[model samples]
Target: MRENDGKSIIIRRSRGWIPINWRDLYEYRELLYFLTWRDLKVKYKQTLLGAAWAVLQPLFMMFMFTIFFGRMAKVPSDGVPYPIFSYSGLILWTYFAGALSMSSNSLVGGSHLISKIYFPRLLMPTASTLAGLVDYLIALGVMVFLMIWYHFPPSPGLLVLPLVVFCGFLAATGVGLWLSAMNVEYRDIRFVIPFLIQLWLFATPVIYPVTMLPEKYRWLLALNPMSGVIEAHRACILGHKPIDWISLEISFAIILLIFITGLYYFKRMEKTFADVI
Candidate 1:
């Protein structure tokens, strides 16, 4: 209970199937900012390379992928240079993967805070995903450098890059909500997250183009939301072809489904977090 003036406010656990209290979240917006900033500080603290690890992680992966997938396997990049092609996709993938991983573990990692505090539990994972944007922006600098070296000029499609990125963020946040809530109950979730990320990386089109698959099989890849996000990034940044509206529409629907369902699930699980954790 908190005291305001001479009055006391009573805090009660939410009843069954309640919708998210957007007002409550808004009221606690400063807490969200604090958590996000704390995550950023904690992420880079005591690291020898500090923020440079963000650039080097994706950059080195791009090099290996360029050699193995681009050179050895002769992967098609829609005529864009393989390095920039792979790097562009990698930057977003790196962000999504990091966001998903961090958020999945957020609740368990913050167990002490969860047990002691009255803040919105959703803020934990939300801040985890939001903090990754710093790393995302840092990695994008390497992409810009690669684009310049490869002589690939930005296209008008760049206008929609933010939307594509939001889609990726939505996917990460949605999955994080589901996994983080479950992780509170099942400790094994932490073990599964790394394997899940590895599989999801291959499922996404980070190292190859969707066109590499036959037309009939292309729909399969489109079913994965990250495919559309990555392909749209290539369209916007590489200017290979016009954006694929149909695929993007499908991806948006799936991402929306995941987000809405994840929200309900997280809220349903929220009441039990303190007890379970």
Candidate 2:
């Protein structure tokens, strides 16, 4: 606790809202990598299919959608093959859903770590979210295969894929932080997550094209952050022309708002996690 020349070894705590310290996170960056790797290992460890499960989930979902939505419901696919069209959205959606599921439970799931050590709790959800990238890549490979099978050539629009993926990550991580923080006190939150995901799935444009929606009601779809991500994915991956910037802008604005508010909520509640969780 000794201080000399206006320097202190320990930064004193304050009652005021704690904003994220990028320096602290950077200093502990190695830990973030470690946690992320740990998640990857634990996820696939002792599994029959191992990492293939990543590809399978989305691949199988794409199959079902190709049958049900493409054939039975006659959903429009923006001129791309229904399988590839749905696969594009499924890949991104699966990653978002998986990350959200894992991250929303990460804090309580790792109760032992929180009780035993001192580190940024924020890193837990972040690690859980990022760990799903492995799954995303595996599923993306499936999408590539589908594209090749369907003779869908690659497009220059693929350049924006990274931005679309970033939006998905932001949206997932933001919601994950909020849920994980709340799950500490409300165990029932875990029960509701599945239903919430199902509802969110229908709300996003994964199974259908955004053009199917009337112009006036497009605003409602834009409110979902993944709407833009999924829409951009379909356009870029399927070589569809002209992304909907309006949707992307709306999604981006919402994600920023969610991320900032979620971070604040997580920080304000994190101090109590160790005790309650």
Candidate 3:
């Protein structure tokens, strides 16, 4: 027993938390990879179409918007082809929506692991968000094909695409962290998430061009972080003129603020997870 106790102490101290021990997170990278892979597998497992569902969703949405908005409502598409324009935004929006949904429910979804394991709780939601990126990449392939079909060449500004995508991830993860933490405490948050995402979809520029908004309202619209990301994506992909830099900067700041606050709140609530959950 004495020898066993000494060995256990050595093991515990060797793996003990260091201040800002994000290195441990890196050390646990394999676990994170497996968790992310598990989510991807579970997402498509036993489904008939499998990963093709990613391409189908935005494609179907584009068809509906083309008929309803472009044909009947006569909504503008910033002088770009309607189908390509909407599909670009929809692809990104779909990833955002999917990440938000998965991350928000990650804690509850992994309740069994939380009850049994001692890994970083943050990994659950982060892995859930990361898993959706695979679908985003698959959907992006269709977006590229649509661009070619519409005779739109990729813009030089497309080089900035990665930064724009990071912003989208930040915005989604920021809100998702808050939702996931709150959800662990209040079951109502789970019900509200779908409704919130639905409302957020229309609020975003997925179906309509931001240019259609009055100039005065454009500033207010930029308060939503997705506004900057969507507009940046259009500017990059469709060779649109430069976006309003001020609005993009403001949106970036807001997203950062939300991310910081959400992380803080999540940490505060994390202590109670094993207890309450």
Q: Give the number of the best model, judged by lDDT.
A: 1
lDDT of 2 at 206: 95
The residue-by-residue lDDT of candidate 3 on 1-277, one tens digit each, is 6776433323332222233347567768899999999999999889999999989998999899999998899999988878888888888899999999899999987888888888877788888888988999999888788878888888888888888888888888888899999999998999999999999899888889888999888777877888878878777877856755676777789999998888878877876787788
Q: List the global CA lDDT of all models.
A: 0.90, 0.89, 0.84
User: How does each model score on TM-score?
Assistant: 0.95, 0.95, 0.91
All predictions: root-mean-square deviation over Cα? 2.4, 1.9, 4.0
lDDT of 1 by residue, 130-249 (tens): 999899989988778887888888889989988998998998999999999999999999999999999989998889887788888887887798888888877887887999988888
Q: Which residue segments of model 2 deviate by more than 4 Å?
A: 1-13
Candidate 1's C-alpha lDDT? 0.90
Candidate 2's residue-wise lDDT over 1-277, tens digit each? 4556433446566586886877778878999999999999988889999999999999899889989999999999888778888888999999999999999999989999998898889999999999998889888887777778878788988898888888889999999999999999899989989999999999999999888999999889877888987898778777776888777888899998998899999999988888888
**For candidate 1, which ten residues in a row score worst on lDDT?**
1-10
Residue pairs with colliding backbones in model 1 are: none
Q: Give candidate 1 misplaced runs (Cα > 4 Å).
A: 1-13
User: What is the lDDT for 165 in model 1?
Assistant: 88
lDDT of 3: 0.84
